[model samples]
Target: MNQFKNGDKAYVIYRNPHTQNVATIQEAIITESPENNEELSLFLMDTHYPLQDDYAIYTTYEEAVKMYNYYFEDNEQSEM
Candidate 1:
């Protein structure tokens, strides 16, 4: 499983590419299910925008990190 430390910045996918949205990693939690399997939920800073506020689910934390970096990092670099 991938681990994301608190305070890492992440981007949530937005419907419009022109209007980018990003969130800061506020918390990470691991919960045990009835099957004794572990699940993860990454809490983000509340975005005032309705569309951007929420937790995004991923099978693994690694996947979430990748998705977050892909959209956020690439865009930031290109802007520079």
Candidate 2:
């Protein structure tokens, strides 16, 4: 398990919950999870989201973009 302290930079591929089709790579900051003192959260888009395994959070923008391209671009082409 990766542990991040406050102010650590994180890169995430964010998909709007209300608009599923819209997605982008966004930078976030690591913060203490408000709901759980023992866990970490990603502060992005004015919201605090608990960091989880399924989020696929990356340490670098390039890593996040690579995953975004694979999921959004390459996946679409492969299905065609």
On lDDT, the candidate that comes out on top is 2
lDDT of 2 by residue, 1-80 (tens): 27668889999888888999789899999998889878888899889988788886888888898999989999779989
Clashes of each: 0, 0
Question: In model 1, which regions exceed 4 Å deviation?
Answer: 1-22, 25-55
lDDT for model 1: 0.44
Worst 10 residues of 1 by lDDT: 44-53
Model 2 stretches astray by more than 4 angstroms: 1-3
Give the winner by TM-score.
2
Error of 2 at 7 (Å): 1.2
TM per candidate comes to 0.36, 0.82
